[model samples]
Target: MPPLPSHEYHVGIICALHIEMAAMRAMLDEEHGTFSKKAIHDHNTYFGGQIHNHNVVIACLPAGIDGVVAAGTVAKDMSRTFEQLRFGLLVGTGAGIPNLEAGVDVRLGDVVVSRPSGVYGGVVQYYRGKSKAGGMWEPKGMLNAPPVVLLTALQSLQAEYELEDSRMPSYLAKMLERRPKMRSMGYARPEMDKDVLYLAAYHHVVGRTTCDACEVAQTLARPPRVSTDPQIHYGVIASGDRVVNDAVTRDRLRQDYGALCVEMEAAGLMNDFPCLVIRGICGYADSHKNENWRRYGAATAAAYAKELLLHASIEETSQEKPVQQILGKSSETTRSEQDWAEQFFSKKQVTFQ
Candidate 1:
């Protein structure tokens, strides 16, 4: 089939880093390349492709420029260039906030899916709202939920998993096999012994890969899994700009919002685009964070996203309103954003072709 036009794509996949975007690029069944003509105002360099039966567009934030503001800008540029984009999937890595008593034992390489579980929507801006007496943000995270088609497909996929096993294991392995260099980049799972959860009181020694130098007995012990396959956790994901490398703040997010996962970019796009967030656990939100698991985490998240989109109903997704139309932004906000973009381009001396 000939390549579809830019307007034909409804699904948009975004990543915070190049590592994450590489996995997304590998998921495309048929890559249509980029648009021959792009809007003058849209500066994003999008990769066009097909996944299952759906045509999709993918993009990643520039290097060293990530977090809420950058993520929001990427999504907005996409909606303008690909006018029919119905929703998005922010697929990347996150910090696991493990709470044994609360039954959320998120380990490195595990995938965390954002879905509405309580008062908050699927993604929560944990940094918002006023502080309560004990210092928890008031439950003012009334954010937008993911589009219904994606949620319905998730329900079906979850039910299917109960009767059978997930394809994540095979998918991840296949990615490494097909793209062998990925293994060298730490996309392959590390040894089970490498997955450690040091006690909250213990801090990192710095300039080291693991906390083995710390008190070994201070690590949190849990039951061993039957297999090396990555497990999926469905729960709320807390989003903020601050890099969470401290245990106190990580536990605080869990105690207050029941956030099984914490990430940096989801909250910025969630309110405007109302998309689902898929993240692979790179480390526990603590000072022990390292680069060891980042590649593997990004890979796992991409695998789950591909599976989720395959199960989604194309008919239902096509029927959903376009993201630009659904954003619900006021005219004043729109004008303000336009003015800012204009000033930004002017200062940078961006000349249109």
Candidate 2:
């Protein structure tokens, strides 16, 4: 393989499930370069390659927080070789916010970007420890970049498609009311089928120890940064230890938090890396989940992400060029007949033949 591009940015693309990553891989062209896969820790598969003239590394980590952390660690470590690491993007399909309509033309593919401010279990624990030790620990004061960025991106995407008022289903609403405490804590049950490797991976990744209620984990971690760009938005994302299958539970959380979307990995991955969580809405957080919509949503979001990266790369390259050269030639003179025409034109009286 040729040496990786010398650009400052090393884009990291992560998909929790194998299928989502496969779909994204198919969309990529030679402009993105070919991907090379390798075995890591003799356990999971890691796909690393270039795309869009960017050094792109794709990893479908075993599902939950721990899996995300492990993959993040690997991605971050790999970025060290580059002179500058621009950003890390988590891309894939996710369960939709409940109570939303699904139709043939709806194009369920919506992208959610996590703010850079992430809340990790370890970080939350660290602060809690400091507080217990009589140190100045305050939960309200903690802040991070990924969550903010993620939130901003979610809002922007929602507005673009006008999915702002989408809500959870009736069944999910009841579940949230019953588990009022869970609702207060921002924990929504997730829906996972046996074939859904992403949800299963999340369970395996976070493990039994770190997998706590979503609220508890996020309260400890920091949120992502809020970009001034109108394209990004910052807000709360629903995370939990279990897959939210009940419609009542999904609706309840949606109505309560006004959450833009729901997913399994954001909380887990955000727990460690202060990164972005972008989800393409696939279906409502209920039994009515549609595989076709989910796949399409994931692809749409990924395409948008690629566009963002490409634009950034072009802008960066432009800035490196000399300003004078960009202006083009200005010293050329016109024929003698044009001198008389130029003099007449100054008074706004001349008309072109």
The best candidate in terms of lDDT: 1
Task: Give the TM-score (vs. native) of candidate 2.
Answer: 0.49
CA deviation > 4 Å runs, candidate 1:
1-3, 207-210, 330-353
Question: Tens digits of per-residue lDDT for model 2 on 92-204?
Answer: 76555523232111114444454422352211111111121332222322223353333444445556446442221222344345545534432232232211212211222
Candidate 1: Cα lDDT at 236? 93
Task: Report residue 60 deviation for candidate 1 (angstroms).
Answer: 0.4
After best superposition, candidate 2 residue 144: deviation in angstroms? 3.0
> Where does the lowest 10-residue lDDT sum fall in candidate 1?
344-353
The backbone clash count of each candidate, in order, is 0, 68
Model 1's alpha-carbon lDDT is 0.81
